[model samples]
Target: MTLRKRLFWLFAPLLVLALLFAYGLSQSLILSRFDRQDAQLLEGEAVRLQNLLEQNLRRNLDLVQSYAQWDTSYEFMHGQHPDYLRRNADPEALSEMNFDFMVFLDLQGRVHAEQWLPPTLTDMFVLDGQPPRSLEALRRAILEQARGLIQTSDEDLYGALIAVQGVPLNLAMGSIQDNQSTLPSAGTLIAGHFLDGERSENLQQQINGTLRLLAADHSVERWAPLPSPGVFSLNRAELSQRHLPNEEQQQILLRFSNSLGQPQMLFELTRDRRLYHEGRKAIAIFLAQATGVSLLALLLIYLGLEFAILRRVSRMHQDIAAIGPDSSQQRLQDRGTDELGRLACEVNRMLERLEQSETRDREILDAIQDGYFEIAPDGQVQAVNRALCNLLDYPAEAMLGQSYERLLSREDAERARQDFALALANNEQIRFSAPLRRGDGSLGHYETRFSLIRDSQGHFAGFRGILRDISEQVAYQNQLLDLAYRDSLTGLGNRKAFSEQLRHALDKAQREQGRLALLYLDLDRFKEVNDRYGHDVGDALLQDIAERLRRTVRQPDRVYRLGGDEFTLVLPDSNSVAAQKLAERLLAELQNAAQIGALSIDFVTPSIGIALYPDHAQNPEALIKAADSAMYEAKRERNRVDLFHPRLLSSSTQSG
Candidate 1:
């Protein structure tokens, strides 16, 4: 029936609820962080496995190139020697090479000599028409799929995953030639390995993950069905989601589409689920801590109400008439050694211990790296830690009675006040990202975690919060964003970035009822220079073009190199005249000779096409298509700029 007991009964459940809510919020945030880590990790694993596959193919192609350049092989293919197979493809040599199959083909696509590791297992390859067992089926598939290898350059190597049998085959092919004999050519040399071999086992061990290429489309049968597509229970509909959800197994699926836009293969990875498990374990530990801390806080609140507020106020006037406002270190002098005097002595000792505990708690709060503060419901600062004082570069005396607006802009402070009021009404958690005004007048980003305070009457009294400086985290995210949107070759915005920018610009134009201009540009004769001078020169030329674009466009304009010799520019709030004039000036500047390491290349020129929103098309994709069609029209004339017309799309469609 005492005042202290009444206060404790009223607020204990609310304290526990606050702790429970905090746990839930923390669990959500931690899981999301883990999910992001898993996604990043899966992406990294995909790249590694992809590179591993390429390396295998490249290694095989290197051997093929070596065999093709052999003068003896060239002579044999040309009918100058008959004992070539006996000398070169002996069992010992085949065992040392350790490849699944090797085949030699003449210039006329006729198989000359073929050797396979397991010569007895001839049923490994299967084609559409041929019987289930025929190496000839494979040869025909190669001829049909990679006939371009017939004219492959001396340095060029062709590598790809081919569905020959029931699994993806890593195949490498190259043209047969003699670098020493100056012979016109021999034919083509091909070498490859099936994924069911020892090589695949070694690959699995390297990444500590299972890798499988899943055959997806069954409606339209493949010409080369994977002979052993493995025991996958997931159907085409399930595979469309990309991954099968599993807790113990973290799976990532990357689907490979064929030329007809049908899913052909699914690149699946089942790696260690350590990160996910670690996240769950962490949440469990946090739950235990939350429960323990909540109980401890409940006890403290009850004792403080009894000792400091209710009992102290009731007994203070009678027992401590001599005590001063700053006389905290002073104690009441009890007169006798009776039971009442003994109880007074015990109470004094308890007060001293409580003082020490309060000091320790304040020290811990001040030691925290994140800023912490408490405010009245009216938004006045009531209490703060040393870290918060340093964070805002304000003295404690200066900030203790001030409004939160001192640390936040008027708009931000108002929003925060609204958020607090909403959370109080709904009895929910509060957290938000906001920019805080710092001492030097620059704004710093912070994530504020908020909790409400209540008086003895259990009414709205104040608020408490922790402000975590997230400037570094924000900068790191920005850096990642830059990497994602930027082209590595020319340092211009890439296709992904262009797509987003175009969409955003279109949205803005529609909202404002203004016009947006999109320019699609292709460099004329860029492939000629790239073929003659190589990629280094091509890269220099692209960078030069990107620089020219940066210099020509206004600061508000967005420029991007879509891919290869293709470039795009998004101009919001641009009129038709401004867009046309910009394109013309860009074309004139591009015509100027580009200097690639002292090589004066005057042949390079740009073919630019302009498309305007509300004038040409409705959406980003359609606008790009229209601009691309107009670009082709300019390319036909060479070194020219063209405007998008509805007929341009029709003409292109008809030509196709």
Candidate 2:
């Protein structure tokens, strides 16, 4: 991208992010405001519910106290009570008291008699062989629960809502003492009220929240397991408002306990999330305003950049594009002293310096002894120095405009293409040895270095390279290798090559899970011949022996002369049986070997020692030593072959 476009993206996102930050802050403030308002509304509802329930509990407890102190309540209790179900009876006072149920306890705190104010005012019927819970069993349960739950005590009066048979009921318990403060308590009385009654419903309507009463039974399971029930325990914190599964509703829970302080029920209060919706609408308005301001800001940024930098840079680009390296008279025009103006002035100075640098680079490229060339983007050789032309034995006119591939051998051409592409991708230079076809169609090895060139915009322009002829260097290296590993006289590998080849053969046998035989031979009576005759006969005889052995072994085998008359043969894929047979052939080959220029030399027979891989030794040194030991035994006995064995190593050691 142009500098102008890059600057625009760089500054444009910053302005947009600034606008986004403003919007984020606004949203945070609005959410905090909504939280405070919701807190106030939920606290108001909780306060109202608490006041109403507390007021009713106090008044009901007072009424229960008045009832428990009556002399009539004492007469009604403290007796072996007959079954109330034995006769149809009406407790008229129960109706007058307007309580749900009442219980009378004896001095021992045992249930003596009870009265219930069921909605129907009668417990005269049975269904499915069962008494109605609201009449018979419910009244009995209330009175039985009043028995100190352990022992009799002079406890004070108490009232709370309790769940009986999954129904929430209000209960108040007081002592049956005299109206005056002088008398001891005679018995206890527990009065009750239905929490889900008309009066409670009217109280619920006083707050603008929906109310639900959950009895402390399986009915309370939908709530979470309590680490601590917040309000009733020590925390006593305001109940956190619950967001209902429905997105638009929220809830607050108020808990109540029974007379003994056991958890009894929950009053779940829910309200529509009016502030939540209003806050979302307010955020929408904020985002809309922010978008407009951000757009205006972005436009101003874009306009300022266009006027200040982009137009000038565009003109500079056009002017630079129109001028070529040959146009030495052309130069850029300066506008002012701003950054772009200074940048243009610097660019004009750069063009002037580049013209001078180009001349100097051209001179350096031409003056260097190494051949130099430049390839255009189209893979055509655009320019070649006189050195390259002379090195290739071709004129400049014959080489220019030709694709570089034509000058290279097929394999090296493909390799050069890959290296060229790598150089361009990595923005680095590469050097490799490649074979180039000379003008005579003969191939000469050359080391090439390739470097990529890019234009002002960093687009690929072409490739430039230097080539050095390495034919003489490569030939000298080969000669050195030959002198190091070859025996000049015998025309076979020397001791160094034999060691290397033996190790290689062992590795091949091991890899293929095959075997090979190593043969160590000594020309018997040969040193005596060297003593009598000249060294020339001895050397000539050894060369002849090497040739005979080469023809005797298989093609995969290799032969080496370890100086004098000592020779070694590597026979791969050969077992013991194969080794013995080859040794026999070698002995027979030397039997008629006296044809050294009419000298009957048959007396020079070989003492061959054969060692098999794995059966005798695994590595090259051990195998060779084993074979050499066996060869000495053969030499001691003359003109016979011996196979290497463990005992031969020991015997050779003893003789030494």
Best by TM-score: 2
What lDDT tens digits, residue by residue, belong to model 1 across residues 1-656?
76666787788778777877877776678777876677667766766765566566667767777888887778778787787767887666766766667788887867888776643334343222233345555456655555543453333345556565444566677667776747676777777666554655688777757775566543432222221121111112112222436776666655543323445455677766677679888887877887788788878877777775566545643555655434676675663475656767887787788778878888999999888999887778988999987887778888888888777777888888789888898877799787888777788888988887888898888788898889889989878987999998877888898888888889988998989988889999999988999988998989988998899988523898888999988988887899889999998889999988889999999999988888889998888888888899999998999998898789779988
Error of 1 at 176 (Å): 99
Best by lDDT: 2
Flag regions of model 2 displaced more than 4 Å: 1-44, 66-117, 121-134, 147-153, 218-243, 259-262, 360-373, 384-656
For residue 470, model 1's alpha carbon misses the true position, in angstroms, by 3.3
Each model's total of backbone clashes: 5, 1
RMSD of 2: 13.5
TM-score of structure candidate 1: 0.45
Evaluated against the true structure, the overall lDDT of model 2 is 0.73
Looking at model 1, which ten-residue stretch has the lowest summed lDDT? 228-237
